[model samples]
Target: FFAGNGNFYTFVVTATTNGVVNINIPAGVAIDYQGNLNTASNQLSRTFGNEYPVYTSSNSGGTISPVSASVGQGLTTSFTVVPYSGYTMTVSGCGGSLVGNTYTTGAIVAICTVTATFTQIATAVLPTVTTGAATSINMNFATGNGNITNIGNQVNSKRGIVYDTSSHALPGNVAPASSSYPNKVEEIGSFNTGAFTENITGLTSNTTYYMRAYSYNSVGYSYGGEVSFTTNIYPTVTLSGYRIFSNINTLNVGTALEAQNTAHVFSNSGDSFRLRFLLHIANSNLSVNGGVFKIQYSLRSGTCDTSFTGESYTDITSDTPVAFYRNFFSNDQVLLTTNANDPTHNSDTVVPQTYVEKNNFSNAIATVPMGQDAEWDVSLFDKSVMDSTSYCVRIIKSDGSLLSGYTVIPEFTTATYKSRGGGGGSMYIENIATPGGTTTGGGSGSGSGSYLTKCSDGIDNDGDNKIDALDPECHAGGTLQGAYVPSNDSETVAPALPTGGCTQNCGGGGGGGDLGYWIRTVYGIFGSQFLRNSMMGSVIVSFR
Candidate 1:
């Protein structure tokens, strides 16, 4: 290579691979303009190199961060352009921004690089992730402060939390651009991030979730450290309850204005007993959400009945047995009113109480409504002392719709040592009519002594053709069990139950259970059974 006497000439040399390449001009390879020959050769050697498909960056007024990258082929990388002190910046290429000063490159099919121009100005930054929590089966959220502190200038930006069970990928991590979360992943957004929280919701339950607070501007998504939380698991609905009254009205005891502590329900023929018990119900998610839940009752009497296959209940063919609300007792007189707080009068449609009605078959006796408070959902029911050969009082839900999964209906069987009947016994709750005439309805045997003996009055108060013990009213223990009287009427009002209530051997099957009151009756088989288990001394024999 020589520059002739004219001026200069150009020569081209290409590098073939990675290594060194040398170009040397031999002796006399050049001549000076003054006709002087070059004594030694001017040597020029160059080294060739292979492609760097991963690393590339640039800096102008500011610095482009991840100053250099080494992520292998096929994957993407995020880069942030932090401005120098007293300098403003701009970016170009790789789907990156210079204004925001941050850029996340797409897939690394080849080398990824960017160029920027930054002017002298104040510096900027990224947003801060403050706090987060998982609250329900389908909802969770994160709170933060969004400011261009360590990040860059923000134009139209996206900010929220991206979450997963195991993966820590951002929302835009996938190639086709979706999420990698396994469950149904939805996000809460658009209202206002300035409002302080990024709501993460509509995810699955009983699962471990991973989340990262994020802000996506021209700078892709700026994420916080990965945070993890597990969702709450709600248990399914389960129905459980025991008998309300065996011998005592447990509802009137202790904090137990509700029924509790009675024998496994044992119904007796010709015996009057009141229904006073509790019901534990849960998981109404399958029921009404923000509405009142209603309860209903049905009975299957006569013989060891076949299993209830959930049918043929509410068909009271004749006018004698239409469903109607009643006071604590089964009154065909004035139906019980709904709750005083009821604005819709829903309780007017059925029984205000939840008693098990007597039936020889699958008969729907009463339907009652429940209140809103969950803890106080349990209430006591009153049975109309109706006796049947083999009867049952079963419960079910009446939400004007059907329910799913486990059987919501639980039955209480009544098979006891029968007690001789006497209508309007001590067990009668709030009866108006009379046996000897106590009710305003002017029932049989009306008298001042007669409390509410609509049954033994020998008058057909219910017009069911039956009289006293023969009537279902007597089965509630109208006569023999004596009548039910309030136990705690200020305690100053003289206990109305045992004294004011029934003085006769109502059903001849003395009382038993809570309130510790024994019914005044003839010492019969059932009476002996209750006394033997609860009162009588133990029996033993020894030989010497």
Candidate 2:
């Protein structure tokens, strides 16, 4: 039978046994309006059966458990999708539902195909971090800072600064604990981001160190840029040199007393001595400017000895020690003058005025320079009430608070001079001139005679070229008036003169007549007895 419409045809066939089926259309069976005939077609046949064909397919990323299958008509079939590692899969072509890795089609009315696909999965990456600069660096410690800009795909397990004396670069794809870095500070329970700080201690002084900020995650460790810093050095103060002046005049004359032990003597109960110190300061750590220098003394009752034992004595505190010279400047240098009271008169006699009278001198503190040796003069003692007592002195430095880490070259010991009663005596002189032509005697006698003492006589008894008050051994109480006569014939030994020539008058005395006028004028202008005396000598030579 055939039923047809315009260019359409239908055929029906029925089978009764379960067997294979083939279908084909023969040529010339149909024709178009143009009268074109179709080619011959093969025969067609079919065997009715209960099963229908099921097909399956997949993309490159995955595979199907079953390539193909057959099911009864109006029944369902399924295919398992197996995706490779780091990949995913999906199915299409057949109307299907997926559960887990399995793809199942709806009831198969005829043959249909199911497809599977796979895609690669993404992997987590390492975190990102940066190191900040070091701060508050000191001799033994410093502060380090860092920041974590990104936490990446995983939470940071730890974050902090890592430091070492030598630098260590962060390795890629390596965990912080497995890295070669020697030291690290991990902030426990700090898995978040942002800035952080750690205090690094036990560092060596004057040493350079490198540091970095780090963060750790499941992927690996991340480190910030590297930073480096150096610790500060400690400061030091050292005593370079020291000298003793027998009296104020010796100090003014730039003479240093070298005798030690009992050989160094203070003849009178009212005599005072001076101690000069040279200090060398180094390093910028100490606050030397506007700092205080102190001289501490211990007094004991006994004969002066190298070892002071068994004699208990009291420390002197009535008079504070001060610099002998005035006008101490910024560099710790002093303007040394022969005469402190009268600046106009040039003389070798030097004495520091009382601290209360000089506004320029610091009563309780002294200013010293850094990185050099500074000269300091301190009035040690006055023997007025210190009979049969021995004393020793040491120095200390301070800046608001006391300073340490200093060494004195030669440790201080007990005093070399022992004070004894009746060491003072008076002498009589025949005549003394008072800057005028008139002559007077100590006992109301008027004739000049050989009875003049060595200190007051017009002759140079020691042949050291210095006469009377001009000689340091004269000990005329820093004046040329011929007062304070010596008790014995043995003259007090004066220390060797310093390298520089006298800056002020080397001798003290009154003047008279035209010579006196010349002396006064020259002394007033030059402030140097050496200059006045030299000019006078030149005048005398010209006259001769």
Candidate 3:
């Protein structure tokens, strides 16, 4: 024993008995204590089987995995605790302290308590769903707003998005399952203090989705408030046929038609020069209101203004894709018989037969939906090219956006063949003439003259609307049915029908004969090539 006043002190006591011992020190024996030594009178002894510094360990709120510890003198025993899900651990009570999740006992001879106190885990705050796109979406989340405040035992954290056709609430056990891509919830790994975003793909197009962001911790998931979005949809389109008009279509009227086969384009000024197409609309359900019917010309025998840079359509596997909308003109277009009585023929009814057409010619649009036909018309503002260029048509979206691939081409043409009597569907003078008629039309080229097929111009030549061929007075005895030769020409006796065709062949001298028979001989002289050049005015036609 050592005291603060360092005086020499010594004690020696021989054992009276081996198993037990008793010691008695007088009251004045220790001055520091100022009393007798009580411990010298009594004693306790240990004779157990395991005696050299025995050690033990334990914990609460969690499990110490290897609780059965070694009891060795100066030997360290390692102990680990297994926390239940959200539970954590703490070591105390005598033996050892915990480093991380492990507890190593100190050099000791006593048992100790390793307490593992478990509490709920706090996950991140609910996430925010930012945007939704075709087949994918963007979601975000953050920490610090979770339900579980126990940050000490946060084993792990993750962020991600959850979505479905319907609503999904927080703390839910079930989530949406899509047959589409990314069939499950997307989870981003743990992050601190910053934003988190995850883009999930394979979402369906044009579908509305309910979505939210989510955070997870050792405890459970915390969700962001609900959000939703829908994708955009584009409709399909298709076209069928178109109608032509030389004049305004009367309003509220059913089916106003103009030239179907042979539409005219006279090269002279102050002549009828108007035409517009009313295309039949189909698939109105897909009316994106983003399309137009554009027509480009391919001119020939007909004359055009010099500055005209004719359009050329290319790139198709077969024929080039020209701007031909609706049904096209075919060879079936015969010479249009100028019949003033024809309901479809309006050039005759239009006042001031010499009045020039300078206005755009088109009709009111009709509703074109599926299972029903409607009209989308194009006003042919420029007419010089139509006289020769053939047409071709195709379907294109209003925005000119692609559908699958190439534009589908339909049958189309603008070649006006000569009809039997200038019939409604007959070709304009461009591709027609009576076998021996002195007029050639169409790509065959044209001939200029007032020397029309005198009998078929459909004009009341002598000041009457009752045209020739049909008017009884126009039969032979009327004013000259031949080309109107200026009255100043000398009168010549009408010659007999010589041999075959020529009854009146002028020999360069200014003379007049039966103009009807004069033109027949003109037919024999010029043939078909000379016939195509005929560009007479105030044309009319009869319809079936």
Best by lDDT: 2
Selected candidate, larger TM-score, 1 vs 3: 1
CA lDDT, candidate 3, residue 191: 45
Candidate lDDT values, in order: 0.36, 0.49, 0.34
Where is the poorest 10-residue window by lDDT in model 2?
Answer: 506-515
lDDT of 3 by residue, 23-100 (tens): 445444454444333233234332223323323344344677564554543445677766667655556643667888
**Per-residue lDDT over 450-486 for candidate 2, one digit per residue giving the tens place of the 0 to 100 score:** 2224443234567777543345564333333333232
| Per-candidate TM-score against the hidden true structure | 0.27, 0.27, 0.23
> Model 1 — TM-score against the truth?
0.27
lDDT of 1 by residue, 148-180 (tens): 233344432455555667964444423213555
Q: Which ranges of candidate 3 are over 4 A from the true structure?
A: 1-236, 247-284, 287-295, 299-368, 383-395, 398-544
Model 2 / residue 427 / CA error / Å: 57
Better of 1 and 2 by lDDT: 2
Which candidate would rank higher by lDDT, 1 or 3?
1
Candidate 1 overall lDDT versus native? 0.36
